[model samples]
Target: MNSLLPVPPRRHWSTWALLAGLLLLVITSFATLPLKWGDFFSADAVRTTADFLHGFAPPELSPNFLLKVGTATFETLAMSAIGTIIAAVFGALLALPASGRFGKAARQATRGVLNVLRSIPELVWASILLIAAGLGPFAGTLALALHTVGVLGRLFADAFENCPPLPAASLRINGAGPAATFLYATLPQCSPQMLSYTLYRWENNIRAAAILGVVGAGGLGQMLKYHLSLFQMQPAATVIIAMLLMVAAVDGLSYVLRRAMTR
Candidate 1:
């Protein structure tokens, strides 16, 4: 009876060909890179890494340095919070048109703008803004806001598009205007999703805020850069530890908020 069962179809040759192509591409990429694999694996490299890591022990616990780290941590948190707020506002505005409530031309134009805003990385945005904002948390804040706006805008538009249409249609049938229908029906359904996306983006912005400081945007990243440049490994390690703690805290908070919303 088992032998009489029909055989499963074999995968097509195209699948195998595509996989082989991908494998070859990977091999070619590794071959073309200028990496010195032998040096990376050498005993001297291992010893050097251990020695360098050893320099960071007993992180600078002095009162003055801890004060500075605390200030920088606050700045990072503020930058991410303010930037996410700004992004949430602008993203929702953009998402309205991008979701096609304003016709095809408006949708296309709005989506194009979103694409442009998001395509430029946060680091690049910070690098450009640093010249104008002049080395502070404000620059980092703006950078986070701009990039996050693009991301949140796209997610919001998708949520709006996928929202259940019956409630909106019923509202319209009962004489609700487009805006009223959206406000009374569509928005209520998708607001939770929008909030979730915003919280997720805020989580990401927190990390970006820290890294933006590397370009002198003013935060823990800036402190880390300064200490590392001067080879102050102990202080740099402290900044790194602060960054980890802050990130972990924000992640937990965002998770709790998202779960609450779902319930």
Candidate 2:
């Protein structure tokens, strides 16, 4: 009787159809592109690539060049740190309305603002701001802050909304004011998660900050772009190495912080 029990029907056709659609899209894209597949894989191409890469060996390690790289690395770090801090403060403020704590009208309005803010990429923001800021770390920092505010605001709102309601509910039942209830009950439970989200965004902002320099927004990317344009492969390599090290250090630090906070 157990063996004869009715079997549940498999419902995997939609997944298979989705995979097939993706495969077809990829094939179509490749077929339509004017790609030089043969030249890319040719022995001569490989040799040229190797020679170009080899030119970057023994990266410029002179004291002056090292100092420049160090300064740029610090600039990038500062841009990301400041940007994330500004975003965290503003994001928390925006989250209050976005989480529907105020009212439906406020939640909708704040969410719309966040959507507009995040819709524009950081690179685009930097490019636009470079005209006004005149090409420096300041533009880069603003770009990162603006984009991060949207991201963190949305994440923070979700964290607030998903917090255990019992605490806030109890506070209200005991005659606590709205501000008091949220401050004492709701904010405490979700603070760690909000912090974790901020840290994660900071990790991304570090990488973005480095790249923003390419647009003359200031930092390691500007150094890399300048050196590369002049065919100074050694110096470019040094800048690239600095970027990698800075990113790695920030990633490690953020990971440790997030772990500690979560614990």
Instruction: Report the poorest 10 consecutive residues by lDDT, candidate 2.
Output: 7-16
Error of 1 at 251 (Å): 1.1
lDDT of 1 by residue, 28-124 (tens): 9999999998999999999999999999998999999999999999999999999999999999999999999999999999999999999999999
lDDT of 2 by residue, 32-94 (tens): 999999999999999999999999998999999899999999999999999999999999999
Error of 1 at 220 (Å): 0.4
Model 1, 116: alpha-carbon shift in Å? 0.6
Separately for all candidates shown, the number of backbone clashes (residues 3 or more apart, or on different chains) is 0, 0
How much is 186 displaced in model 2, in angstroms?
1.3
